[model samples]
Target chain A: MFVSGLGYIIGETFKGLYRNRWMCITSTGVVVVTLLMLGLFMLVNLNIDHITETVKEQVEIVVYIEDQAAQEAVNDLYKQLSEHRQVEEVTYVSSEEHMRRLQMQLGGMLEGYDSALDNPLLASYEIKTVVPESVVELAEEFETYPAVSTVFYGQGYVENLFAVTGVLQYVGMALMLGLAVTAIFLISHTIKLTVMMRRKEIVIMKYVGASNWFIRWPFLMEGLLMGLVGAVVPLVILYYLYQYSIEWVAGNNLYFLSLLPAEPVIRELAKYLIPLGTGLGIIGSTFSIGRFLRV
Target chain B: MVEADNVSMKYNRCKQYALEDVSFSISRGEFVFIVGSSGAGKSTLLKLIIREIKPTAGLMKVFGKDISRLPRRRLPSLRRSIGMVFQDFRLIDDRTVSENVAFALMVTGASRRDIRKKVPHVLGLVGLQEKAKERVCDLSGGEQQRVGLARALVNRPSIIMADEPTGNLDPGTALDIMNLLRSINLSGTTVLVATHNREIVDRFKKRVIYLDQGKLIGDEQKGIYTHVR
Candidate 1:
């Protein structure tokens, strides 16, 4: 009996779809457009996240030591900088070594200006901090050190990147949510119109004493079928587009965008698209039938 | 058996009454006719028996259960014991005659084996066994009415309520259907038919309840259409 009921429901759904071919096609088309737009937004958002992470990894703070410090004192300052928790790496550049490297790069251009330097440049240790935010605190801490002259890093660029990425993530999430709600409402209303057209059949079923579930199951199944079809076209189109775009990026060596790896992104999209399609279908069918099912 | 005590039904905030202070009882194994012209509350009374509509005031009992207070969820099980036929011959257009007959049993979760055995038997009883494979839309009006009757009788309910079962049929086909209903009643199922066919009333000579303007004006045993011309 259960098997027969299931068969009957499946048969009925197909019969309904065949009878209203144009409406079914139109609803599916709407679903495809909605899902495609959503997929595109998600892809762009994922790439933005990857790019921000890459930028964060490369940002570092540079610390400088005092000019008059002795060689022993400079070595001591280097050890102190290395021992700091926020410091990634530390190196000491002597005044004489720095001058020699500059002269090799600009030998004849700087020959007349050698006597102008009454004082030698400071022999400094270059310290790289692990985190961009820790630069200010490190600079303040280093200022208290007797062998430290000054500390500086790109504070403005770091703050601006964080703010911009934060706003982008918020806007992306809001847009996706709005699109989902609109899709659900549109699909549900379309299915509701279909139910309204066949209300005479529903009334007869009710009079014949069909259970509410029995009356509703076929329509719900129809909605599920609609959702499945709607998701399929967009999913296929988006999947190929993602693959092609990733291949293009890889081929042209556009590494600065730092896009998400293709495999993981595709897997995540599959997880989202299937359920989203099913939910839209089920919700639409339910709303349409619920109006007439009320005894 | 069916009984109604002081039943009254008002609609749209008591501005109009469909059935007013009506009371009657039908015995087991008896064939009863409810006769009246249009707007006489015949359908409203039938709807009350099937629990399709509740009375605004009064008590109705069918098969010893107080149906006036029955929950909506329990109405289906209650209705399974009572068969109803509509004037329009409300057969599912997409279904075959046999499938339509089997639908009543299907809703009650009857086994396919039982449906296979019983559907043919009921179709034969209704004299539509040959046309069982045909779609209802393909059948003539009389044939469609027979299909409706076959569907109504498939479960072997204790009582059958038909509202103008022959309203759309020709005189010859209507008489044939009346004969079929008589045979069904002879098989020990109580029948309540609501119609305004004076010829059928005179021919059947059954107990009749006559109503006018939502009021039961007369009741007679072995009665014909006795209201004034």
Candidate 2:
């Protein structure tokens, strides 16, 4: 009984949608635009995560050693750097190893001038901090070490990166929420007009012994189809655009930004956005029909 | 099939009542007329019997069951046993005559085979079988009321309550509808007609319950419209 009734209701809903073709298209268009905005914000979040991972990887402080420091003092400084609370890992490079690294960096120009000229490169401890933002404060602390000559961390760049990401996260969520509510209201308002137009049908149904649920089923189906159309169209367009974005970034070999690969990210996004769009459609239709059902 | 005792309905807390101290009972297969002019609470009485509004005071029953205490879920089944026709005829203008009649059966969970069979039978009873494929909007006023009557009877309810069924028809067409309703009543379906049509009320000479200013002033056996102008 339920299956056949459901089939009938679905057929009726299809008829209703076709009858209200202009409204359906306008409603679907608004839903697509709003969902596209939501998709863009999600992309922003994914890329922000990617950028943070890269920045974290490159966020170590380098402490250069005093050239005339005693061997014992250098050993003590290395031990302290390793044991510091903020230091994640510390590696000590001897002056000879540093000289060899410098020779490699300078290429053949600085090669083969060894012990007689002495190792001019300073020995350093390469430090990785637990938090990228802590690099500056930790670098200052390392400068107080007895054998440390200088501490280097790009403080302004690190602070600005963290600050910008924090603001972006806040603004992205606010815009997404605001736009989502607007979409629901807009879609439901349009559906409300359709419901009003069909009110005579509802009154007739009520008089003829149709249950409230029986009347509601077709409207619910209509809402679901509209939502599916709205969501799927933008999702396909977003999928293609997302693929193009990844390819463009890869083709340019852009050093400033690194996005996660398209295959997993777009596929993962599909798993969430499609259901969300459908849910919003249901919600919108429910809003439209709520008052009418009370009669 | 319906009972009421000292029933009253107040639409507002601070306003006068729509129905006050009204009491009546209706038996199965009894053709009755609730006769009154405008503002006599005739429609309000019907609405109360259908549980459209809870009586502000006293008890009302349908099919020997107290309706004031009936559960919300049970209302549909109660209404299914009693069909309603409105003054406007309330046909879906967009649908064909056949579909309009079939809609009544479909919503009540009738099988497709039953709908196909019964829709034609009821439309034939209303003498609109030839016009089954025509949209209701294309039908004349009398034809449209016949379609409404077809819809009301398709469900085969024990009782049918019509509010001013002939209000939109000419005198000749109104008499034709009255004859159709009388035949249905004779065939053992209870009928309640709420109307201010004086000539039909006088000519039919049926059981009449008269109301004036939300009060039941008289009940007459084979009564005519007795209100003074």
Candidate 3:
């Protein structure tokens, strides 16, 4: 009984979809456009969150040592910084390693400086704080050390990045939520119109002793189909577009910024967007058919 | 098979009553006609029996159970036991005759094998076996009503209530439909028809329940369209 009934319901759902093909297409289009906007915002927000976290993790105070500082003073300073409660780690970069890094970055500049005597770079202690926000106080303390020649931690830029990313997250979420609500409303109205055209059939079904569930199953399934199509279309389009974006960023060598990887981001987006779209479709049809069920 | 005791129904927010102090009992296998002019409550009484509307006052029972007190969940079971035909021959016009008939069985969770078997048999009973594949919209008014009858009978309900089933057909066609109903009744399925067609009502000479101004004016066994008292 259950198998036959399920077959009947599925058959009816397909029949209804064909009967109102234009309406289904229109509703599916609405779902696609809405989810696209929401998905784009979600991707952008995720990437933004990734970029900010990367920058925050790189936040550290670099204290350059004086050229004449005693070896004991430098060792004492490194041990003290590592023991500090606010510091997570302290790595000492010798002047020779510093000149080698400059050679790698600048490439060909000071190429003849093969000996330590020609290396003008000072040895430094890099301090990683437990909290990125505590870098200001830690940098000030490091600058007061007698062996320290200079202290730097990208103070203004780091603060501004954190503040900007926080606001962007909230704004993106609000916009996505608004788009979702609008999509549900528009899709429901479209399904409502389709159901209204079939009101007589529903009444006839009721008169023939069909339970409410028997009549409702078809419409619900149709809604789910429309939603699934809507969701998958945008996901496919976004997947390719996101992959291209990551490649474009890499190809252009925009080294100051990095995007979240395409595969994982798109996969996570699909996980949420598909269910949301299908759930919206069901809700739309359920509410649309509610008024006609009175018969 | 059916009973109504002092039933009264008034539409919501309306002062006029649709059915007032109407009482009648239809036994199993009985062929009964409810004859009355428009707004005389013939259709309203049929609607009441089908449990479409609860009476504003008094008790109504079908198969010895008070339908007025039946829970909403059980209404479908009550409706399935009684088949109903409409004046408009209400059917899905785009579908074939067989599909329309099969729909009645499908709703009650009948198996596909059962539908495949019963649909052909019911179509044969209505003499539409050859036209089973034809769409309902393409059939004549008489043929459409036959399709309606086929749909109503496929469920094998104990009672059949038809509301002006032949209102759209000519006199000759109406008489043919009436004869079909009579034969169905003779086969031991209780039939209740609501019609104002005096010719068909008189020719049957079966039980007639007369109504006037929402009241039961007369009920006579072996009666005609017009009752002399």
For candidate 2, the iRMS in Å is 2.3
Q: What is each candidate's DockQ, to 2 decimals?
A: 0.38, 0.52, 0.50
Candidate 2, which segments miss by more than 4 Å at Cα? A1-6, A9-22, A52-57, A66-119, A144-147, A250-255, B226-229
Which 10 successive residues of model 2 chain A have the least lDDT summed? A1-10
Give lDDT for model 3: 0.87
Clashing pairs in 1: none
Q: Give a tens-digit lDDT track for model 3, residues A128-238.
A: 899887888889988998788999898799778768867877787787788767766766676677777788888888888888888899999998998899889999999
Question: How accurate is chain B of model 2, given as a TM-score from 0 to 1?
Answer: 0.97
Model 3 lDDT, residue A12, Cα = 88
**lDDT score of residue A104 within candidate 2:** 79
Better of 1 and 3 by lDDT: 3
In candidate 2, how many Å is residue B181 off? 1.5
Summing lDDT over every window of 10 consecutive residues in candidate 1 chain B, give the lowest-scoring window.
B220-229
Backbone N/Cα/C clashes per model: 0, 0, 0
lDDT of 2 by residue, A128-185 (tens): 9887778877888888889899887776777787788678767767876786677667
lDDT of 3 at A169: 71
Which lDDT values do the candidates have, in the order given?
A: 0.81, 0.82, 0.87
RMSD of each: 4.6, 3.3, 3.8
Residue runs of model 1 more than 4 Å from their true location after superposition = A1-32, A68-148, A191-202, A216-233, A283-291, B12-14, B170-172, B197-203, B224-229
